[model samples]
Target: MVRNPGRRAALVDAAVEVLARDGARGLTFRAVDGAAGVPNGTASNYFVSRDDLLAQVAGQIHQRVAPDPEEVAAVMAAPPSRALVVELVEWINRRVAGDRTGYLAMLELRLEATRRPELQKELTRTIRAARDDDLRFHRESGLPGDATAVRLMYLAMTGLMLEQLTLPGVVPAEETQGLISALVDRAIGPEGAA
Candidate 1:
């Protein structure tokens, strides 16, 4: 396989597009190559197999949607509280909203994982690790609540995103901010902590 980082990244990106538009079953090497506008077999050269492509798509999406360093630094500089938590949630919501395709690809992977035990195990570990990271962040910030709070917040945000992306009008756009604010309030407790 070629060691060209740029090319590999492009293939992964194409895979995400395919996964989002066609779902897991359509995420083949040829499909990625076509979506990437690369030569036939190019995707094969970059990814060892479909699973590798799926994993890379997940990684690329994570990187794409990760908070900006400047944003994180600014937030970190402030004291952690319910308001901070709300801002963070809003920031994440905005990012995910902007990258609907990437998030959709991620959801597709989740469905695909259900039928693939090995993929299911890997994704579960990855998701758990992300939850751990969030829990650590909350703990370090001295935010209110504990790991359960973090987990609940994560669940709320995921559900919100799913609705926002799949059936946007199900919850009016104006109500979303209010709903998230309430979720954060409850998740962090009466003190707005965590």
Candidate 2:
């Protein structure tokens, strides 16, 4: 096995590319090595096993990605408002655009995880933790129906993203934010949720 950090990084990167381009099934040592321009023996030497490679690839993806940063303030502020919606929609737009396959790839990974208990549990924990974070954010912000609405918010985004997957071109970011803004507007009413 290669003890050099640089070589290990190169192999992991190659594995990510393979997972992104051809998904898990296509992620083989020889192919990843070929894709990385590294020798087959070298790639195998670095990765050791296919499961090891997949775990590395999955961990790499998880470490790099974060929940939508649209609510940097809400994630950090109190009594969140319109800015939350604006930031969130912007985050989603940027997310989908930057990596069209990213969200889709997640869906694919999740479906595959159904047959793999460890993977399924890991994914479930990831999702549940995300939901918990959002719920806590809303509660701290004093958003009405903090619990219920917070839950709904997740559904809304998932539904919207699913729509995006199908239509791809529909729902401009501006319009999407506008819709959320309206909801927030209705929530705060004339009091202003500052």
Candidate 3:
């Protein structure tokens, strides 16, 4: 859709920073313009509309969350130990903390999408694509309760993210390890696990 995709990407990156720093309630066109170091008119011109700008920011967050081939491979290859789960949780926590404004903006976008069909459709597609990737990982593992592990993995990841947001100071690494170990036990039991 963009002739120079790089320019669009720059706007999205800027949007994420602005959204996180300012939060959804504080974000404004002029704010993004300043944060992006672009002319005030530039953001409006490129994004075309307010909703368009919000959607682009939200889309970028989804893109970040969704596992591309590289990420999936990295996660899959990461030893499959409880420590690996802690690492992954740490990774997700960093992504969320890296831009709280952007994350909050995404939450706002999700709420808005609920009332707008087009936005809802894109969000659905993005989430379903992520779910499918998870399913694929379980399928490839060829381990008992692979499906359950995959599901619980997502749930625990989400819960951790929420915890991080709720109490950023307290999500210790040990808690992450415990969560992973518990999930693994529920999914595979001690006997089935390696």
Candidate 4:
């Protein structure tokens, strides 16, 4: 395998675009090479196989959609409250929305996982670990919610994002922020407890 980190990262990113635009079946090494604007065999050099490329792309999408640390720090500077939770959820929604292609690529991975058991296991572990991290962060950050609240909020927000991204017209743009606020409030309760 190639040891060039920059080239590997580029290939992974290009694979993400191909996955997002063409779904799993279309995620060929040639497609990634063309998308990366590199030589035809460049992706093949970096990735051992199609599964390897898919795995790399999966990891890259998470990084691409992760929250900005600076933004998290700024938000944390405020006192923890239901309002803060609402703000955090809104930020998450915005982050995912901002990277439309990355999120779409992630969704494609989920669909692909249905046909590949190894990929399914990998995705399950990765997603569950991320959820656990979110739960820990919410508790430690003094955010207004317990684990259950956090879980509910996550589910609600995920559904909302799916509808918003996959079918834009389903949720009116004007109502998204308000809906996010409502999701936080309901999940955390009036007193911001579980």
Candidate 5:
């Protein structure tokens, strides 16, 4: 594969756009090249196959949506509680709200994975790693939760995000923080006295 980080990144971003707008079925090398505004076959040069492109897109989605280091540090510095968990959920929700396209592309990747065992394995591995990381962070941050609690929070947030993104009026944007707060409190509990 070509080793031009800048170009490769651009192509991947373009692929994300295409995937979000057109779904996995519409994600093709030519479409990505066109979306990237590069010459024909540029995407193919960067990604050898469809699965390669999809896998890279999976990795890129996490990179694009991850919280900034400073934001993470600030949160981690605070005493852990349901409120802190709510804050984290709100942070992620804000990102999803701001970049609906990227989140949609991620959902598209999930659907595509269902039909491709190779991609499914890759996604399962990556998602497992992320879940494990979340568990570790929860423990280190003194968050009042176990792995199962974390998983439940993840599911709830995912559902909330999907509804908010897919059916905008289904969950009022202004109420999202409150909803997250409620979910987190229900899943964990009130903060310990600081």
Candidate 6:
């Protein structure tokens, strides 16, 4: 494969855009090259195959959608409480909503993974690791929830984001914040629990 990190990253990012806009079937080396504005065969040089490109895109989307360390630190500065958990969950929702393309690409990857065992395994590992990290952080940060609460929050937020991104009108924009607060309250317990 190509040893140039910057070029490889650019190609993978282009692939993300293609995947988000055109779905997995439209994600081809030429499409990525066109999206990246590189030579026609440039993507093939960077990725051994379409699956490799998909795997790299999966990793990139995770990084793109990950929480900023500074933002996490700022949130952590607050005393742990159910209210803080609600704030954290809302922040997460906002972050994902802001990166619509990346999240859409991630959704594409999930759909494509069903047909490819390797891709499925890779995504499973990637997502599970992220979930494990969230569980660890929730415990260490003294967040107002247990592992079960965190897990439930993940499920609820995933569903909420899916609906909001793919079918925005279903949730009604004005009610999103209220729903997020309720999700946190129900999953983590009452505001005064911790």
Model 6 Cα lDDT, one tens digit per residue, 1-194 = 66999999899889999999999999999999999999899999988989888988988889988988998899889898888888898888888888999999999999999999999999999999999999999999888788998999999999998998899999998998999888887887787664
lDDT of 2 at 155: 72
Evaluate residue 181 in candidate 2 and report its C-alpha lDDT on the 0 to 100 scale: 59
Residue-pair clashes per candidate: 3, 1, 5, 0, 0, 0
Which ten-residue region of model 5 has the weakest summed lDDT? 185-194
RMSD in Å for model 4: 1.4
In what order do the candidates fall by TM-score, top score first?
Answer: 6, 4, 5, 1, 3, 2
Candidate 4 residues 1-194, lDDT tens each? Answer: 77999989988999999999999999999999999999899998988899999888877788888888898898899998888888888888888778989998999999999998988999988999999999999999877777998999989988888887799999987898998887877887765355
What residue runs in model 4 are displaced by over 4 Å at the alpha carbon? 191-194
Q: Give the per-residue lDDT digits (tens) of candidate 2, residues 18-114.
A: 6667777887898788878976678788777876776566555654456545546545454445565445545755676576555655655666677
RMSD of each: 1.9, 4.1, 3.5, 1.4, 1.9, 1.1
What is the TM-score (0 to 1) of candidate 1? Answer: 0.91
Name the lDDT value of residue 21 in candidate 4. 95
Scored by Cα lDDT, where does model 3 land? 0.67
**Cα lDDT for residue 31, candidate 2:** 79
- Give the Cα lDDT of each candidate: 0.84, 0.65, 0.67, 0.88, 0.86, 0.91
Could you tell me the lDDT of residue 114 within candidate 6? 99
**Residue-level lDDT tens digits of model 5 in 66-174:** 7788989987776766777877888888889789999999888889999999888988888888888888888877778777888999999889888977888999888
Per-residue C-alpha lDDT of model 1 across residues 25-91, encoded as one tens digit per residue? 9999999999999999998888888888877876677676677878888877878667777888888
* Ranking 1 against 4 by TM-score, winner: 4
List model 3 lDDT by residue over 1-194, tens digit each: 33567777877777777766665555577777787787776676677776787778767887665445787577668555545544554566666767555556666666667787887888778777877876775566543456667777677776776666657667775666566666656755654355
Model 4 residue 149 lDDT?
A: 85
Model 1 segments beyond 4 Å from truth? 191-194
Best by lDDT: 6
| The candidate that achieves the highest TM-score relative to the unseen native structure | 6
The reply for model 3, stretches above 4 Å from the true place, is: 1-4, 66-75, 78-105, 169-173, 191-194
